[model samples]
Target: MNWYVVYTKPKWEKKVAERLNAIGVVAYCPLITKESQWSDRKKMVQVPLFNSYVFVQIEEKERNRIFEVVGAVRYLFWLGKPALVKDSEIEAIRSWLSVPETYEVAAEQWKKGDKIVLESGPFSSQSAVIQEVKKNHYVLILESLGCVLKVNKKEI
Candidate 1:
């Protein structure tokens, strides 16, 4: 069996995962707790780490069974075929999430145009170039991911 990415309806990742599991399919929906502020107060809420995406482990012949669950739209396609998530990648996510949240990174002076490799977090081991250095955060360009990421000082 291989793990495949499933696209879900907006804000339905958790529900779809649950429904899939109820039907005997192994589903994983990674979640992270974030502090949300309302007008009155602040609260910590668990949100899906990847919006509208859930991972399901199933055999290729049984791929169509996933559609039996509501909110499960379709499988994510890459290079014209269903995207397969490697077992090592899935284990990495599990290990990353299982570890304690406390992280202590030695503060280092970083300047613009500096090339650095991330030592932790989701993009660990990936190199990024510092695009802008601000007092509270740094904007980095991840060429491999083709996205600009804003990393706060506390998170570095």
Candidate 2:
């Protein structure tokens, strides 16, 4: 059996993982606790670490069974093949999340209009243009992903 990446409907990561598990599929949906603020109050909520993605472990012949669960759109494909996640990588994530710690990130001095490539994180190796630089964060535009990212200085 191998681990496969599944793309899910927007905001369906946790639900899809639960449904897959109920159907005898080993599913993983990594989540992180974040503080959400509303006009009335603030609360801690669990949000999926990676939006719209879930991991499932199954044999090649059982791949199609994942579709039985709602919200599972399709397997993530890379290079014309289904994207596979190594078990070691999965274990690494598990171990990393288990420990709670603060990290000091050293950000390079970047100016507006400077093009840079992300070395890690979800947008690893993606080229981005620095649109705006603020005291606390940098606004980056990722052309390939067609998204604007506001990354914190501590996360850079």
Candidate 3:
């Protein structure tokens, strides 16, 4: 059997994955624990790392049955056929999430000249290079516009 990508309804990845597993479909929904904060307190929440995507190990014959599950929209197709995910890629995700702290810290260990991409907000989709790293802020040089800006660690 090969791993295929399944697109689920918005915010239904975990729920869809549970239903798939109960029906004997081997589904993998990768999650990441993020520190969420309200005014009073902070807590960690397990959120789907890939948002609406889930991986299912199955044969091509089982496609129709898999799509019958609630919230399962369809398989991700590439060039008119269902895309297959490599086993090594799945294992890499598992190993990375196994030691989540290491991954978080490694992202923060930015050295000068390291390339970084803005993940969200107004400056999103913009690529910048590290000019310097301060206590908790990064000085990035937006080369395309010839601008230097200070951004918080979380912004990247």
Best candidate (score: TM-score): 1
List the global CA lDDT of all models: 0.90, 0.88, 0.83
| lDDT digits (tens) for residues 57-149 of candidate 3 | 998888777776899999999999999998977986786577525212224778899998865544455789999888777789988657897
Q: How many collisions between residues are there in candidate 1?
A: 0
TM value for model 1: 0.72
lDDT leaderboard ranking: 1, 2, 3
- Prediction 2 TM-score vs. true: 0.66
How much is 57 displaced in model 3, in angstroms? 0.4
Cα deviation of 126 in candidate 2 (Å)?
Answer: 22
Residues 116-151 of candidate 2: C-alpha lDDT, one tens digit per residue:
998656565679999998998889999986889887
lDDT of 1 by residue, 34-61 (tens): 9999999999999998999999999999
What's the distance in Å from true for residue 90, model 2? 0.2
Identify the runs in model 1 with alpha carbons over 4 angstroms from their true place.
36-42, 88-104, 154-156
Worst 10 residues of 1 by lDDT: 99-108
Better of 2 and 3 by TM-score: 2
User: Taking the candidates one at a time, how many backbone clashes does each contain?
Assistant: 0, 0, 0
Q: What is candidate 2's local distance difference test score?
A: 0.88
Residue 37 lDDT (model 1):
100
For model 3, the stretches where C-alpha displacement exceeds 4 angstroms are: 103-156
